[model samples]
Target: MSVPHAKLPAWAEYGLIPLVNLAVAFLISGLVVLIVGESPLEAAYHMINGAFGRGEYIGFTLYYTTTFIFTGLAVAVAFHCGLFNIGGEGQAYIGGIGVALACLSFDRVLPWYLLFPIAVIGAAFFGALWAMIPGWLQAKRGSHIVITTIMFNFIAASLMNYLLNRVFKPLGSMSLETRTFETGGQLPKLDWLMSIFGLSVGNAPFNISFLLALLAAFGVWVLIWRTKLGYEMRTMGHSPAAARYAGIKEAKIIVITMMISGALAGMMALNPIMGEQFRMQLDFVQGAGFVGIAVALIGRSHPAGIIPAALLFGMLYQGGAEISFEMPSISRDMIVIIQGLVILFAGALEHMFRPAITRIIFGLSPKGRQAAATKGA
Candidate 1:
């Protein structure tokens, strides 16, 4: 059956579905909190306070937001391209190697100014390279990307173990091969940013990576909406035959999109290697590639939609940590329970809420719409 075409204003279509999903995600989170024998209301308030009420807290939350955006954008892009590029874990693993090598190579040879960009570009390229082979296989051999990428994930994990054990192993350490970046290779303090606010180290990890994530999100928005390439991707996603009929090369675009997707995943290195930590280690990220799927679902596969979704994940994750520390009775795994429920609701919101969940406006109410229109006019 041909899909019925329903074109709402971009705001109504993309904006509405995600807003509905967000409400559902939060509701699920709340119920989980209640089930944990905690007051949902108080837990939520504490979560918000831990995330943003204090200056340091905001920085930390942004720290989580930065990398989640990278991995989530990776997943979102592949979803739009009609490909489930599930190899984000592997790509990120490979990227860690790239960043580590770049940091090591440039440490004595280059200045901090040049080394940072070098490391970022190197990480992204390596990430893209890791993803390209599976993309090629899918396009050429009609392989299932999900299966291929999952296999590659094992390969990536194995490769990480090998490299840390052999190639990148610091001479003395046998414990999982984590080596610190040379001082020059380390990400510099955001003295310049903090200088402006007169709040030195307001948040240690809230560095330039946050700015880059926001820019990348905006860039993804423009790429998917304003660019011809993105339109082709969306078309391919909806109907590959129609896309081919429209003169789009499905194979080429698929491979390219996966490369971009993997590259975005590789950018995950920055969250750990370029923040206060300044080096990539195996556990620097935690199942980020997998969680990215949840992020994309919650974000409704739109770039702008990703922001709050990531922030929500960040808050729960941060709150989970604080809760574990303070309560002693609760463990961090409880947050995982909340996250699992949120994902369930976001994924099944339509079934859960049915029709009435249809007409909710999140940030843009009717009054806000009029204000926006009047201002634009």
Candidate 2:
């Protein structure tokens, strides 16, 4: 039997704790900057300016944010079902195949408005299918999801490499990518959205897919909080034995949850495929799938939390580039260290301050007071 833990107030759990962790991360990062003989304040100023300085900068930041949102939500959904899915990279890779096929088939005959829905379906289907096999093995064959998912990512990369080189590459092109899509296959930029803020999108690739990512986040919120299946998922996540006793089908839920997670990951391909690249390219995921893990961790596996968490990473990525450019002494490796520190505090060390926080808040309730006393003893 497990001892019940004291719960923090919603404000502290959701807001204060995360803020504390972020502050610590920045402090450590500042120390590193100082050790390297640069002013942390100046580096921070440049980072902020780089990520949000111009209309184009903001657009690029949001573009990266859009990809992170889909992948972050993917990880979050599986987390709610008590599963860790590390195969978002592979799922997104396979999903590119679906997007490419759809665009190649209809680019000449159909307008983007008509093709977009088909591409969405194709991306979702392929992504879900790729994820289902691992879920099935975990459910029926006792395979570990983390191990299997990791293996699948390697498999996916190999499969895509073969397909691109032998199958999809156009004749005599001497390139690993397919033919670029025509106008009908390309998604329109969300210049109107930028204009509303009196900003121009400029050459940034922010597009309709950003809006789609926001809608998907809203849909995930409804699914996790409003639907009956979501209740079962949460219950299972809390305790598999209890969920089983309550008549929730564990096997079915696992498969479905994995599929949903994969579909969201697969949709990540849409941002690069239609919104920016306008064609499938090698390794276009650019490690966003792995970044999703950190995003979900920082977000606490909630859609509402996931959005801002995604934006934070977006800022890190865009700003890291600026730091490298403006402060050559800082170096790209130094920027990576800053990001790694944030992930370390926000993810691996998330609970480092929890005990102290609980002690501070534990006196408000008789139960909490008793628990604190019991812990002290």
Candidate 3:
């Protein structure tokens, strides 16, 4: 007879396990800092102070958070449908093209309010269209999503390069970027929102897009947990055979889910392009697409979990920059190492400490101990 193992409590599974892993990661990272001849506690203080010490730093952190939130949701949504859509980088790149087309063509005539919606729709449509190719391949041709999506990223980069250099480059301009967007195309700053609370953010990039990201999170929650389509997607993810028995069309779900994921990733372009750069430029994505994978894993592929995870990464990014500037001993590469450790612990090694923790929890719980005793007999 096989002995049954006791299940961990929800709190231990969701809460304690992650905390222990994070602590271990940080502890290891601290050792790395010490080895490099720096004080770990001082580094920690600098990171915290840099990320949230001032109103401006807070704004920058939140600005980064907005991009991660959209991409993380994109990853999470597809994960729910059992799809690994790694094309967020490409989707976001094409989405920026869509936004640029809409803004450049109509910014002179349309009001900002009217233009913004058009830009958003363009971004979503183009993103979905780009992703449709990979989705169709996966659904119809049986192509693996991971391979196709990675290829699509390279394709997107090349396409954008050609467009920016040959097609959209303004006359008499040497830069590999489009002409500056018209005033009407620009997104208004949210400094007034801060001012309402008697705080100033000192020209940070945080904008209305932050609110849109939050709304997207709520929307993802509803789409995943409260809808029939979501149910079908989840069912398909759990078991294709069972889903087929229930008459859920796996192909349709795969395609639709990927398109939705692509759309969310595309929306991330709005923050950097319209809100910050005010022009279409090369490399605006800055690897936020890839970062979504880490965010999704750390967040456990849930919208509620994704928000805090995105914010945490945002803090790491902003704080990392600050510490690198202040402490020459802690280079940018060192900061990346620290970030890598977090990702490693949160994702790949997430369960490394789970068994030990489970035993401890089991020891402390009467019901758990009783179950273990019964199983042993």
- TM-score per prediction, in order, is 0.86, 0.93, 0.94
lDDT of 2 by residue, 222-304 (tens): 99999999999999999999999999999999999999999999999999999999999989898888888878988998988
Candidate 2: lDDT of 155?
Answer: 97
Worst 10-residue lDDT window for candidate 3 reads 1-10
C-alpha RMSD in Å of predicted model 1 compared with the true structure: 5.2
User: How many clashing pairs in candidate 2?
Assistant: 0
What's the distance in Å from true for residue 328, model 2? 2.3
Backbone clashes for every candidate come to 0, 0, 0
Clashes of 3: 0
Candidate with more favorable, higher lDDT: 2 or 3: 2
Scored by lDDT, the top model is 2
- Prediction 3 TM-score vs. true: 0.94
